[model samples]
Target: MSSSAPNAVLSVSGIGKTYAQPVLSNIDLTLLRGEVLALTGENGAGKSTLSKIIGGLVTPTTGQMLFNGRAYTPGSRTQAEELGIRMVMQELNLLPTLSVAENLFLDNLPSHGGWISRKQLRSAAIEAMAQVGLDAIDPDTLVGELGIGHQQMVEIARNLIGDCHVLILDEPTAMLTAREVEMLFDQISRLQARGVAIIYISHRLEELARVAQRIAVLRDGNLVCVEPMANYNSEQLVNLMVGRELGEHMDMGVRTIGAPALTVKGLSRADKVLDVSFEVRAGEIFGISGLIGAGRTELLRLIYGADIADSGTVALGSPAKVADIRSPVDAVRHGIALITEDRKGEGLLLTQSISANIALGNMPAISSAGLVNGRDESALAQRQIDAMRIRSSSPDQLVCELSGGNQQKVVIGRWLERDCAVLLFDEPTRGIDVGAKFDIYALLGELTRQGKALVVVSSDLRELMLICDRIGVLSAGRLIETFERDSWTQDELLAAAFAGYQKRDALLHEAAPRNTL
Candidate 1:
């Protein structure tokens, strides 16, 4: 559709953004009232850049925007919000120290005579929280106490509070549960009924097909296609996004399976993880699949010594001798590495250069007598840059400058420099695109070929089935069942994931007293 179309609620002409180099170029797009538009592309394809431009997070270098056929130039996010435009970015923006209610209505708190009205705030917060399936959480509770998934919901609820004519959601479901995703979709439907335009960005092809009315695929900072969602299938959409045909199956390189490399026995950490026991053999990939709040991450944290296990033993090697791992340093000494889900927060030092970040754990190799060797650090970072095919200008470039996929590569490169016996990956391909996901899968294959034991935790069941030799299902803080690669089906795995919760709910119902008239 053209920018002058009557139904267009917002339109951009010749939109582009640049930082050190051109990222977005000559983008012309229109958002119609009461319609969902899907924006998709590979990592570093400038989708986020364009959205930021529209949402006033970033100013366009060369473009003009029109809202309802009038000139619209927002200098800041607050200006955009005042103009009824909102964006929910992938990286959450919330005050962890403040209560959920405060964070939700911080800009426009309900007050009387310059004093905050707790009653009014709580009532309004409850109404908003219920729409996003967060009614169980107390509004007075600090946002820091909630999990990442709930924080994402609160961010969404905050944007949904005031008037919003155009809403942009960037990977909104990346940290959300299946039920929460449905609730968000229901809210989206309600907003659509109110004539609110939406721009939905995600890597999941199925969700795009379900929620988007029109699909726009960007590649290499260019707009390639804009068509109705029904015009293309998932495969076609992926092909358009990546500019190549990708197969559904993967060819994992052959490797010899050896004795157990890492074993956990009776691992329990409060109610988050309960008596979890598993073994990952050398050259084997053990996958963990579970719904949100099922304690998948907690189990990984305990194994990596990031969290203490109340009662458990972590044994290493074939003879299986228990290792005394109390902290991350000890875990590293014992040859265990964890690639955290919060890569930005835990994995990399964004303000530092690529060489500096890679030199973190490999200080011994890059330093001499309490001094870092510049040449050695550059060489180390360059090796991984070439090996992982990380697209960066130079080793001196800051980690914050790279895209999501490239940043993840930097994290993996740091661990690859070490001879770790076991590797734990939490949502390795969480926010990456389809092509980048395959890159990670291939890396896992290479790691296994090198006799490294790998444990992967993913929210996507299909991902586990694709790369895992054996998959373990976590349900309600317990390991429900483990399924072999070929022996498991989607339906069976999902059923097993919910089994523990079902049993717990049944017992709770049976224990409750019933009243009769």
Candidate 2:
């Protein structure tokens, strides 16, 4: 739908936010009615700050926000909602104890005078859920009973039911399946038809190309560029976002495959992970690529012992059989490390200092007689920080204060300190910028040069193609296929990832039982 008609739906002019230091400066953005504007940048590039300003979660230190060509400043979330603006954050905000229906129309529950109208509320909730392609979830079902993907859908449904004219989604597809992402795109198309201006933010540049008409780039608290999607490719978009050419195909010669460092046999995790098996060779860069919910992350979690496996045997070099690693500590002791996908929630201690977080995994090295050697710790932390090129005010600064890229580096530094022989990185570059991504790739290469085995799980096929020696593809909790780096193109990888290896054969097999019956 073309939004070339007169008044813009939302206009942000000279928007500047200054915390203790400048967060965003002299920014200008416009969202036309029915247009999807993708806001993208490196983590800590002030994109979230800008979104908060629009959603009224934060008041700009300077400048103004105009809605319908009228000066508008929402003092609170309720005010923003009242003004037909709503934000669906990356982190879900649903009450687990409440039913799906209750979470859907939480703000304006249907009521007759002073009494509640439960029946009307459920009907409305169903309608809203239908809009987001989530009709399977019962309205009365407790939110806690739903999966993460379902809960995400509930959040999106809630915004739609609010009759929001302006919708802001921050990293909405970060954890959604391919089918779920398609469902969301369909909903966005419908919302656009109704003249709802959307501010879409995500680390996945490819999705932005598909859904957004215009793209805005932010870098270091400044609006660097804004242009139509027709004018840019993935490479150009990344270049603009990071202000540098992220070198094509990082050097991987440093890591040469040797004997197996770790091996998994018949790994099973109920329905999500089924008879999965893989091996990581020392000094090799192994990658796992799959659509969300394909069991890649789950398999990694099982191997790391973050989650229990009903059946599996893990061998960690030297004829040692690890029966069952019940916890992360056991995995660590076996020289295995897993960098979690949710860096904020699982990987880093945001409130702690960078030095403390970086040194946390290798505390024994700095401890003598149960006393930490402060000087030794500082030196070790500083060495890793310099090597990783972590951009921070100081090692003493809280990790929460660093950019997403820097924080990720801190996490990597922690694992590096442990001198782990095997490392599993899940979405290691999800929220980081292009420049930092290159740095991480280089670090991975360096680690492998030192004979450390690495396994990377990523949603971006291009990343896997560029950095990994071999790639494994998963679909529906099954290990569908594997490919050497030279064996497949990005298009082929994506095809296998989305369509699976034997679609026709699988369908034929499923139909065989029915045909015989």
Q: Which candidate's lDDT is highest?
A: 1
List model 1 lDDT by residue over 1-517, tens digit each: 8987888999998998888888888998999999999999988788778888889989999989999889999999999999999999877889989999999999999999999999999999998899898888899999977767788899999999989999999989887767788999999999999999999999999899999999998887889888999999888888988899999988887978899999999999998999899999999999999888899888998988999999999999999989999998899999999998777668989999999999997999989899999999999999988887777889999998887778888988898868899999988888788887888899899999999999999888888899999999999999999999799999999999899999889988898877632
Against the true structure, candidate 1 reaches a TM-score of: 0.96
Model 2 segments more than 4 A misplaced:
1-5, 94-102, 109-126, 137-151, 233-235, 389-391, 403-406, 491-517
TM-scores of the models, in the order given: 0.96, 0.88
| Pairs that collide, model 2 | none
lDDT of the structure predicted as candidate 2: 0.83
* Candidate with best TM-score: 1
Instruction: Report the Cα lDDT for residue 353, model 1.
Output: 95
Model 2 C-alpha lDDT per residue in residues 1-517, reported as the tens digit of each score:
1223384898888999987789899998888989999988876788878888898888999998778878889998789989999999765678989999999887788999967799998889889899888886789999876655678888988888756899999888766767788999999998999999999998777889999999999988898888899999889887888777776767766556888888888999887888888887899888998876678888988988888999977788746466458998889888889988666657899999988987788889888898989988888889888887786667888987776667778888888867788999988876666677777888888889899889999877788888898898887777777889799887677777766536745877888867565
lDDT of each: 0.90, 0.83
For candidate 1, the 10 contiguous residues with the lowest summed lDDT are 508-517
Show where candidate 1 strays beyond 4 Å: 513-517
Question: Over the full model, what C-alpha lDDT does candidate 1 score relative to the true structure?
Answer: 0.90
Please list the Cα RMSD from the true structure of every candidate, rounded to 1 decimal place: 1.7, 3.7
